[model samples]
Target: MPYRKYSELAELVEMMSMAVTSGRFMNKLDDGTYYNLQDSYETFPVKKFENAKKSYAQGIEEDEELLFLFDITLFGSATDGMIITNKKIYFKDFLEDPECIDYVEIDKIIDRKISDEECEMTLCHKGKATKIKIPRFQFFDHHFIQFIAGYAEILQQNNHLLAQGKAVLKDGVDNITDIIFDAFWNGKKVEKIR
Candidate 1:
């Protein structure tokens, strides 16, 4: 839901950077990487809805928590290309189940091959088009954390740069009263106790 609202990928990056610097719910690891507290809370075994139906048919209670975990992982991978490889997750069970299958769809697109044109043109003239290959980006658990922490550290180191800019909106002119609020009022309800 949060990812859906972002207009561009760069905006999401900026928000993530802000979140890391704001210290809302991120933790710094020993290796100078930052770990999102939300990730740990949301982690669970991946399962498919059809597999859950089969489990129900087999007299096993449907595990909604497991399904939620699977969705989280899938969404995380799609948004960041980061695969969280933790042994505790029951990914094998999801794969082995006949009713459920992990989603893996790769789309191939054809682009103009400038290399052939370049070779032909270069044989006649000195000008030639260069072929460039772009590398794919991957974000693993360690790297993701490191990325967050690196940004956070950079923000801390460059506090003066941020302070130099004038604030468009001013803070409250007068003191504000404290207000009590339910912690989980605006948060997702935890389904399982374990």
Candidate 2:
């Protein structure tokens, strides 16, 4: 069988869409505040959050649509945002747009701290370190946090196996993909194999 590059991306989009639509997403806005997933969109005002508002207005422009998004703010100002598409994750700075990171580019999850009030995480990707702070109830309390890290590990494995051989890659990747899909779609427990 020939390697289908987009197959994994397509599968991921499906899995992530389930996570979003099922209300299993953890949404954190600016100001270190938390909202129930049900109230996620309420944080965005049309004039202030221009990009995010545009995304909402356009409505599913791609098959690889946005699964989850975070308005990354500094000192009560929305300067950047995190957008999770079906394929990759992006840290979009309003001043300059840089390339996003794929699963394979994510080196490791450096640190994660969850307190009663908020959660903070550090990730090293592509030799760059990034810090993310959000309310504990938004991310740490739900499975979406697990999905983000888990998907990266799985994607790294999938790419490695694909580089090995088509036959070997299919079996290894499908197994992991099935497990992850079931966890997100069927409410199955994900084995933290990595």
Candidate 3:
């Protein structure tokens, strides 16, 4: 399966970093095109492998998953003020994992406007509301560096899902001709059933 070239991943990280730092949502416009506010700038660049490795070592020693995730999130926030946010898919395994426990600590950083009497807790985009505990912090630390590390790991593991065709770039365009032509020709030659 094809993976995103390192350059492409770098570009994506840069764009996300910029969006978070500027307090702008990276939403698609009604025209089906993507754009960001011009005034926005990246909080920080993603750390290189050497730096990540060093931090990972320290993180493992801390035996704190939230700290680890926080480290990852803050990777991008080092240059600018912390302004990162995290959104997990919310799965059983994720909740059970110690690392995930740390990840949930992100809620502490969000700034919710609701008061304790008005607050309601709901499951991942579903289920009935229930009374729940709220943490002291309202938002996750918007650390750009840590976010870079965590997101990069996710992308690396799931790169196969992004494959559209063989790895080839011609004249600055991703080449998908081989896969497309092969599929078209082979599709025509398949045997028909009565």
Error of 3 at 139 (Å): 15
Question: Which candidate, 1 or 2, would have the higher TM-score against the true structure?
Answer: 2
Residues 3-25 of candidate 2 have per-residue lDDT tens digits of 32334433543555553554433
Segments in model 1 whose C-alpha atoms lie over 4 Å from true places = 1-36, 39-142, 153-158, 165-194
Better of 1 and 3 by TM-score: 3
Top-lDDT candidate index: 2
lDDT of 1 by residue, 49-97 (tens): 3443334223223321221112222332211111211111122122333
Tell me the whole-model lDDT of each prediction, alpha carbons only: 0.24, 0.51, 0.26
Of models 2 and 3, which has the larger TM-score? 2
Candidate 1 differs from the real structure by a C-alpha RMSD in angstroms, to one decimal, of 20.7
The ten-residue window of minimal lDDT in model 1 covers 173-182
TM-score of candidate 2 versus the correct structure, residues matched by position? 0.54
Q: What is the lDDT of residue 184 in candidate 3?
A: 24
Angstrom error of the Cα, residue 48, model 1: value is 29
